[model samples]
Target chain A: MTSETTPKSLRTIPREKAFYFFTSIGNYTGLSASSLKDFLEKINQVNIKSLEFHLNRGDFEKWLNEVLEDKKLAEQLGRLQRSNLSGDILRSQLYEIVSRHYKELTTRAAFSM
Target chain B: MKLKNNTIALDATDYKILEALREDARQTYTDIGEQLGIAHSTVYDRIKRMEQYGIIKQYTTIVDAEKAGAKKITAIMTIYTEPKESEKVAEKLCKAPEILEVYTSLSEELQIIAKITAENQESLHTFIANSIAPLPGVLRIRTSILTKKFKENAFSIVSDPKKITFIKETRNIERRETV
Candidate 1:
């Protein structure tokens, strides 16, 4: 199988899972999406979401609320908050959200944290 | 001073105060008032209210990396460790100064993701290799650094969409499961 099709690569991370994953990555690395694309890409290639579960251990929800205070993105995310989605879609959306506002939503040192 | 968590209501002025702080935290209340066309006292009041409501947290200075002569290395450190020792390992990492941030990822296949900052790449490497890698319970570590500085700043996602959304809905994707 190609790298993309491997079990580790092909598995899907649902929205909730993706939320945890991206948030953890953010908290740990201080990296917003644009800065950490290479890192995400590497993790993506491996088809693993270990980064999502472990790093988001602090007061992340509150921090998320503060940092991602975009009413619009919050609204869009709210629509999916209770609604369940697949892991892959969620992962993509997480990356999209970060990539979209990466330049703006993060500090210079955020990713390297 | 007392620290109380005040969860209360907010208004347009409160939002404006937050917006100002987000842009430049060092702006004086007088400067803020000049920009907002309000009295400095009014700006102070609004800011206090926002802080009371937990809307505005702390103010900080934004440092320019190029001018500071600090090397910015952004990496995703994937760690491998035994299942039982996860918490212990994470705790140990929390104490390490060079290891600024650590995240336990959902992709359990990799134990942790870390971001490191140092005066130079050599210090960063030494920190990761000698300091981080040698820690007990750490099995393997892989790292990648920023090749080019793209952009670093925060933007309001609610107000802007055209600028924020890049990966469209059609991309094929995958998710790594926890081990």
Candidate 2:
């Protein structure tokens, strides 16, 4: 998947919201036999520079805990917690979200914080 | 992953069918239908779809490595190469049947990770020293022989998530706990 410079509403959302959104996309893509191993392989091969950015575990964890109380995002996150989605699927989903919301994402870096 | 093969989506029903096939690929459509409460024709359709989509790639028997006198070893090979030689090395590695799975990780230590299974240490040694080493851009090779298979196939764990918890417990369970 290729990255987009124009960001979407997804990029403006905090890490928790972005995680849940991408996680859902991962589920939809990986229902078959796709695993994280396959997804990571795809990401590593992708030509997108912004797509190559890796999120820190500490940041992910912090965002996860904060959003764990939000019922809606939590529900989506719970669906992803099942560990059914492939890593490649999640990567693709993030790539899609990033590309789709490139302009929005780029314009508002402060929104993410 | 490389887009060399086709991929298909699988539903819950399809997963059940896959579970049965994993244990016995020779199972009759009627038997699977009976167990799944579906008609024989439906079973056939599902299997056909799986084949067409590449979910059920090829059904083959699992030969016992020890019983067949085939000393098995599991080694994680890390290949380092420049961008120019990536395709060349990947193409060459794909031709070797011993290599089962390959993944490119997001780590500095390794770029491409390959899992290889061989008959004996000598054969495995030759495979690494000769077949893999000769690749155009191969810069390094790190291999670890599998002393024991704590957990092998991902198919089992993926098909049944319960296996994950079971494996975790089994790994921690003491031998004395059984008695």
Candidate 3:
């Protein structure tokens, strides 16, 4: 099914759950050293209510593409469209995926250096 | 009065002094001392120590902006910034006359949260567009207009004795419920 046809339940991003996901990504990404620190910082600063509204309305991926101009990241986030997962579980899964991507990037950077 | 190196440890007497001063910063040390039954010199000493410890930043008047013919439209703006530019951006925003407070948020999507004030919505829009948007490293800004203000720095250092009693009674009720 198209992303547009995705159920509302799949799109829900709760505040505390979102907060956990964002903060985990921020910490793992190492804000002081990572190149995407600003991008992550921006994500961290968005009000919880605003983030919830955007995610609930399914504008999150669009916002990432348009504002952040990170289509790959947006597309990666788009993978979190499973209808069966509960909100908390979905958030945890999203956090794991993003954290893994950053972890790999961190390892690559360490190896390159 | 004994000083705790740099940071002064406040006691009941210190809290009473703070409460008195908060009520009226203009109140004389003598008046505060009289009210609290302490020596004026002791009150002065406590205040001086508190200031040194940065507990008391500055003494300033709280103005009724609307009554003073300066109506303000306040909005909370969430800002995204480039890596390590959040501090610089926050500092720049703070320097602007229209911005009231800039706070760093722990969220991943936002870098800073700034409270801005303008005479009207048009001015607020213009300031955000012209001044804030142009700041280097500022990636995005989302504003939410404040509708009502219930409290502004309303917490008291000195707790009301009645409230403390009420809290104790409530705790007993909560304990009973848990039991």
Q: TM-score per candidate, in order?
A: 0.44, 0.47, 0.52
| Candidate 1 structure quality by residue, lDDT tens digits, A6-113 | 322122332222222222222222222211333345335423243333222222233234343345444444444344443666557545654554444333224334
Best by TM-score: 3
* Residue-wise C-alpha lDDT for candidate 3, range A1-113, written one tens digit per residue: 43355322223332212222112101111111112333244344434443343354344465456443546656776656433343455555545655665566456555555
Residue B90 deviation, candidate 1, in Å?
3.6
Per-residue CA lDDT of candidate 2, range B120-147, in tens? 7667755664466545565555566667
Segments in model 1 whose C-alpha atoms lie over 4 Å from true places: A1-113, B1-6, B9-12, B33-39, B50-55, B71-74, B80-84, B108-110, B119-122, B155-179
Name the best candidate (by DockQ). 3
Of candidates 2 and 1, the better by DockQ: 1
**Which residue segments of model 3 deviate by more than 4 Å?**
A1-113, B160-179
Candidate 2 segments whose C-alpha is farther than 4 A from its true place: A1-113, B1-9, B154-179
User: In candidate 3, how many Å is residue A93 off?
Assistant: 41
Q: List the lowest-lDDT window of 10 residues for candidate 1 chain B.
A: B166-175
Root-mean-square deviation of every model: 24.8, 24.2, 15.1
The interface root mean square deviation of candidate 1 comes to 11.7
